[model samples]
Target: MKIFIKTFIFLIIIIPLRAYPQACCTGGAPLSSSLGVISYTGENLVIDFSYDFNTMKDLYAGNSQLNDKQRERSTNSTILRFTYALNNKWAITTVLPYVWQEQTVRSNVGKTVQSSSGIGDIVLLGQYAILQNKKNLVLLAMGPKFPTGSTSKTDNEFGLLLPPDLQPGTGSWDGIGAVSYSRFGIFRPTLSLYTLFSYRYSFQVGRYDGQQEYRFGNEMVINIGLTDSFLLKKWILNPSLQFKYRNTQKDENNGSSFPNTGGSWMYLVPSLDIELSPKIYLHSNFEIPIHTDVVGTQLVTSFKGNIGINYTLNFKKNKAYKIKD
Candidate 1:
């Protein structure tokens, strides 16, 4: 029994730390509002603030070949999410993000640095509860992403347009749809499971730089997780393990597909959520890629970290009151 426990601990603590590929074309805030059960009673307002960072250093070709040159990219993102629940059945959410990015490329002449900082694209989503019970909950959501971020940022030293991959926005509008399902008390009283799937479809931009047409490929993401809860005196501790899969299509430029733009990746994530009070919660998570197969030679993510806080406010001031005659 002791050996089994040690093995489990090692798998959870050490296996997910290995390096992985950086995402090629898809660029958006890494944090999104979590899907949860809604009560059929008073209205609720939920706000979340999160910070995320990722580093990409090694380049890989096809599936397992590493290139010679050393190239690196780093990104830091801050995200804000707001959710309003009208009733137990319907909700709406908005997400905004600010991004700071740096790209370093190595060549025979030397290394060059390019950086950009701006507001990223905004996303608005509406969610509806399809089924809700004591043990299970299901939700459906759809949304549109606006190209509010800048795509024409230029480098400071060279005064030239930065690459499309480093731009804050994709220069095109996109649509996203999602389905989430969760089940509680499945194996034990303290264990719960959930799965979320989302798809994003991209639209073509006529002329991004007045000459070349550009469009990022459509993307899909899937996540499955299990959470175990422990009651620790006055606070509740919840630890979760999640698996995430992402697939993106190739990018198009001037009516032709670009190489090393998209691929499929799998990641393992471990997260912890701490409840300070009934209305306040803190969360942190780490993501590491385990499997990756790109179209060609591309930069990949080595590590990603996220930390956040969530606050829920309940209002019952406007509830219908009966007059006592």
Candidate 2:
């Protein structure tokens, strides 16, 4: 009877994990649309807002016999972002997300399930341009991530099952630093290299339960872009490759043991930007995870894609106005 009870508890924990699969990267692509907002800022301060929606589904079979099988799991999320350029060299951005997730499991004994929905983490970031040159190159940006989301709720069955890294509200502070360089090459092709690093440490406070100390291991993202601009045509095509590496760390029930869950991932991202009018344009990109270590054997079977729309409101200066009209 004791053995059966322990097995039942284990199954409960595994079921939710199998259902959610864990979310690694933030929704959409690696590059932020507002990253370059300051570069094009005019008078009156420019503001841009974007919305993205993503949907993912997955099915897994544990063994060859297919006896240990799981049905499909689906997740839908909507993210809204806003950016405001303070000047030509600095800007601030924020993202708010809402997620709806569902899980269904199937076995010889029949089927079991759970589901939940809530507001995800809220991230506030700032960008600063350190250097720029009109003809050849530019270097910019870095910021911090504040814990504005909630973390107190933990549903053992359904609802927003929190990952170790994102527990709704981490109740801790974190910092991120990044630098990107874009250079113009021959044939009008632009080459850009971006590198980013982030770290977060959680304090044992409030409803932290035990002396569980949580720390986000070092995380890095590298992106290389090949972009081309066509003369007279308001269109730009950028094909890029992104590489990500994350080292995991966890400590619970004191400082006895902490296992490492490190992994690397790579994706191919292609983006197209077109100008609809003078300063209005539509941008979109498809990011497909091609290789990964954290995904295990189910890498291909489980993948995510993002689509977003951005609207830029550019500011213009009034040259005719005099100081004392």
Candidate 3:
């Protein structure tokens, strides 16, 4: 039973990331866990607000590093997530984000800054609980990623079409498929473990000028992690650690594929969650790349950080909600 619980928790905790573009690197992998899906409730409505920061400075070609060339990119994203339980076994989630992106590149004319800001792609998912018990959970989720963000944003200073990597949106529709399973108390009652797998399939989109088509490469991610909760007098402290392996296929443009636009990456993430009260929760995560192998030369993220807060409203009149330690 203990081995089964450990294996189960190792596989389910990683599948909760909502699909969205992040950072300046066009091919950067999405965060493995964006919402509190691993720790959730039934018959309750949850609202989450989060902020993400990513910085890019290193340039890599294939597996070799090149000079930075005084080029840098940064992205700041604000996201809102709504999760509603239709009932005990069914739930739906919606995610909306606003992004601010900036890229600085050195040119013969000097250094120039290109930036864009607006709404990003939206994601909707339906979640079903395949199994739920006091110490284990199995879930299946599927979702459609919508192209509600602006793809044709222009840089007024350059008077040219900025590269797709610097855009706020991918401009393509996509689909997400995910599976997760989690188990608790493998070692101790306060210890939890989970693992998850997610895949994002991309559909092509035509540029606003009708001159070319841009398609973000398909993405696959696998994650495994564990968390332990410590009880305080009035506060619950939870710390987590996760490992993620992500791969992205090469992107296509106007029927031609681009190199250096997609590759495989591995990340180590550490996070913390605090339950301030029964209805309020706060979480934060920091991610660092452990290894990266790209198809061609591209800029990669150096580090990423995110923080979020969630508010839960319980509508189960007959049951009193309690925060778990």
Candidate 4:
């Protein structure tokens, strides 16, 4: 029994070290409201947009033996963001997101299969530049997640199961605050640190439904640039590590709860942004779960691959009228 306990602890500590690819979540860097560090000056305006899709299949340890017992999930997300320079001292930014998710579960007896689908919540954020210079920086951001998604269980699984929006989106008023700093060393590459905090309050579920409330946890991330250059002058690589701490929460009636549900994770996440002309570029990353504590008899998930594109639109400056010589 003692040996088993020690082995379990060892697995938990070693799993997150395999260096997963830096996908959107999983092993990637924390989400930032900033477009990236300012490499140029002027009243620059940028409109950044992207789409992401993810799917998970056959989740859980007993799924293989249970025949019909299985779980699957898929998600599609779209984000539209805008940034404007309020002089060199500060800037303002906003992000609008739309998400669609689907989940399917099968019973062990092969007697029943359940599924749900719907839109998720929407979020808005604002950012301020607290400090900026040639080699160091600091920034702050705050935002709210609105209950714009479908909370009605009718949208999913026979009106009996919880919808993805309700299960993951936290159907309540919530706020997020973040602080980030980065520094460049003369002998090496840039290093960055980020911390995020979130708070949520549950809502009353009318008369017939049960009331549920939960307080999520906090997250911290650190990133180190392994190399400042790659493949000549058009590509760069960065490796980073991220840690998440989750607080315990429970179902009031059941008295069952998830403990230490949060764990630390690490990944190599090498990102490449290629310059395809000045207006278009290609970006991609692969995140693999090296270690995770989200394991058990029920289900487990790991990191995967992500690839995408980016386009920049530059408004042309008006040319001076030529006078006859």
Positional deviation of 90 in candidate 4, in angstroms? 2.8
Model 2 quality (TM-score): 0.68
Model 2, CA-based lDDT:
0.45
Let me know the TM-score candidate 4 reaches against the reference structure.
Answer: 0.62
The per-model lDDT (C-alpha) reads: 0.71, 0.45, 0.70, 0.40
- lDDT for predicted candidate 1 compared with the true structure: 0.71
Poorly placed runs, candidate 1 (over 4 Å): 1-25, 31-41, 65-69, 206-209, 317-325
State candidate 3's TM-score. Answer: 0.86
Q: Please, what are the lDDT tens digits per residue for candidate 1 over residues 1-325? A: 9867644553443222212224554555543323322333458787888888888875777678486545678988888878787877778878888888887655444556668888888888887878877677788888888888788888785455666667787677889788878787887977888888888888877554478787888888888888888989999898999998888888887879776678888889898888888788898888888987888777877788888898888774322100000
lDDT for each residue of candidate 2 in 201-312, tens digit (9 for 90 to 100): 3333233564455443345555555555443455543344444334333332243333323345556666655546544455555556555454221211244445555555
Each prediction's TM-score against the native? 0.86, 0.68, 0.86, 0.62
Of the candidates shown, which would achieve the greatest lDDT relative to the real structure? 1
Candidate 2's C-alpha runs over 4 A off are 1-38, 41-75, 154-169, 189-211, 231-260, 295-301, 317-325
lDDT of 3 at 167: 63
Local accuracy of candidate 4 as per-residue lDDT tens digits, 181-259: 5554546544444333332223322212545433333334433332233344565333333443322122121233323
| Tens digit per residue, CA lDDT, model 3, 1-325 | 9866644442332111001122224422242344334334457788989998988777776666677556677888888888888776777888787888887665443455668887877878887778877887887788877778777777664344555666667777788878888787878997878788888898888875688888878878887888898988899998988887888888887878765577888889888888898788898888799888887666777888888898888887322121111
How many collisions per candidate? 4, 4, 9, 8
